[model samples]
Target: MSERHVTFDMIVQAVGAVAGITHHEIMVAGRAGADERVHLRYACWWLASKMTSLGPSAVGRLSGGRDHTMVIHGQRRAEELRATSESFRLSTDALLGTLQALERAGLLRFAVTIDPLATARRVLSAPEREAVRVSTYEIVAMSRLIVEQADGDPSEPSTEETAHAA
Candidate 1:
């Protein structure tokens, strides 16, 4: 598949769409513990760092002007979560898949290949393959939710609770 240049904004937007969260929520300055907003922010940082040529520092700047250390920490945490948490891994993998599908369909301005496992492994200190519990139905549902949100569907799940659920 042909790869396309995916912008930071595009990555943030797509991830936000799949996660049922918003860019504002992610970029908002805060040290909110391990909440959904924080999770989304970290996921955004990890995705941006991988999907683009931007370094940790640039990713930090885009993500609320966070310091490189903070970006690094977030990336490390994301890697840890991806390796240890099945739900977290599925959520992240699903978002990446959604972005890839969007790119391939030309719904996005560019086309990009996103290999979640490979990307995560690239950042992981110790990578291990775990059986994925996510079914095709769940992935399709996540994709549908993302598409609806992107289309500005009024019925889209945008509530904080719904966003947290993803």
Candidate 2:
């Protein structure tokens, strides 16, 4: 068989795609000086964000290849770096955008399902209004929401919700 190719970038892409998340410039290698800790810490953030386990304990556990203190140190350093570094900020935005794009491209996570039944009142059309009355109220994915605008809030309404009301 021809050699099946596998690389860190490919692995990260696969992981990200399966998680309904996205990332870019997935480099796997040794780091130099400050970059070493920064990269590992960044990886921790990226992975935890994808897993949505950003709590202190969860992140500490996940990032613990070294001592938990090291993970904490990295996390603190990254937070500090973000405070004053414009270039880092731009790079972070770019990386996050790549992840989001990968998600939209169906590379990282499962498709988000939609919710059909809503608790909306006086906001939907006559047909939608009636539909909600009969539909049971529950959480919905609602991937595609197309409704006429009413006030600023889509879920709530007030006297001002309908300016057309006389």
Candidate 3:
């Protein structure tokens, strides 16, 4: 396999890790097509475009075969959000930190400013951190429910199961 392929994979992993979603979710637009998902997708495109030799069209192709216009629009929107929204800026910074961590771990060859710890500390105030934690928990719980439903296992845990669960 080519180094580029590996780098692309790393990029995808980094995005998923920072966004708190699975790689599958990153690839799929999702049922709700929520703004959060769209933003993350845009972030993916922006990061790939910035870091790789690939043009907008190529980056678009990599990100769910989106058109070049979509790539341009998404990147532009993300850039605008970063300029205007503090939370969005922090989130993007956090993502950059993850990418940098990937680079440090030798999962990626490119150089990125890895300051996720510091940036997280600086950006996420106490209440914000708690919110993020709660949000993550909720997302995980919801994802689990979705998976169980998809598998045709909608039965709730019985008292016996709960009793032995702990």
Candidate 4:
């Protein structure tokens, strides 16, 4: 009804566009919880969608009135859990693939960075995507990164650690 309300609705739509969960579902899931800032709220919607259309009650309780952080933590935990569990990883890859499709459909942008227009072709190329799938390094890396970002903690990679991984 109000301009502020419209802006909030758009955020929900954008998140729904990316997660395919819809604004109505997010509203219902949220229950009576704190807003928890913008990015965190988006994370909440995504986790709620992932957990069997589960309402926002679980997430709300965990967030400590910080639904946004709760969302980030929940997704982070989901990703961490996904790493050692084959079925979980498969489920995630499937969900992410579907979400990426929606993003590619103009609902949102994946923003695959590139060196040049010529090099950009490789970003979405099947061979390139397949090349990156050398086991399950992504979920682990991403969850850690998200946790670090949300917690304001830097992910300091020691030179030895980097060299070892390399």
Task: Give candidates' CA RMSD values in order.
Answer: 16.6, 18.4, 15.4, 17.3
- Give lDDT for model 2: 0.41
The per-model lDDT (C-alpha) reads 0.67, 0.41, 0.62, 0.43
Off by over 4 Å in 2: 1-40, 54-64, 109-166
For candidate 4, lDDT tens digit of each residue in 32-124?
543423333544345444422334554443233346555656566656656666865664466456554554455542232111222334434
Better of 3 and 4 by TM-score: 3
- lDDT for each residue of candidate 1 in 41-110, tens digit (9 for 90 to 100): 7788777766667788877766656899998998889999899989988988887777667766777653
- Of candidates 4 and 3, the better by lDDT: 3
The residue-by-residue lDDT of candidate 2 on 7-69, one tens digit each, is 223334444454343322122223444364355345445433443433445444333224555
TM-score of each: 0.58, 0.37, 0.55, 0.28
Residue 89 C-alpha lDDT in model 4: 61
130 in model 2: Cα distance from truth in Å? 59
**lDDT tens per residue, model 3, 1-166:** 1233224445666777877776557666656767878877777777776555577887665565689899899889989988998988887778767665655566754333222233345445675454443334334434543553353233456566689998
The parts of candidate 3 lying over 4 Å away from their true place are 1-6, 31-33, 101-166
Off by over 4 Å in 1: 1-4, 31-34, 110-166
Candidate 3 lDDT (Cα, 0 to 1): 0.62
Cα lDDT for residue 76, candidate 1:
88
Pairs clashing in candidate 3?
none
**Top candidate (lDDT):** 1
Cα deviation of 83 in candidate 4 (Å)?
A: 0.8
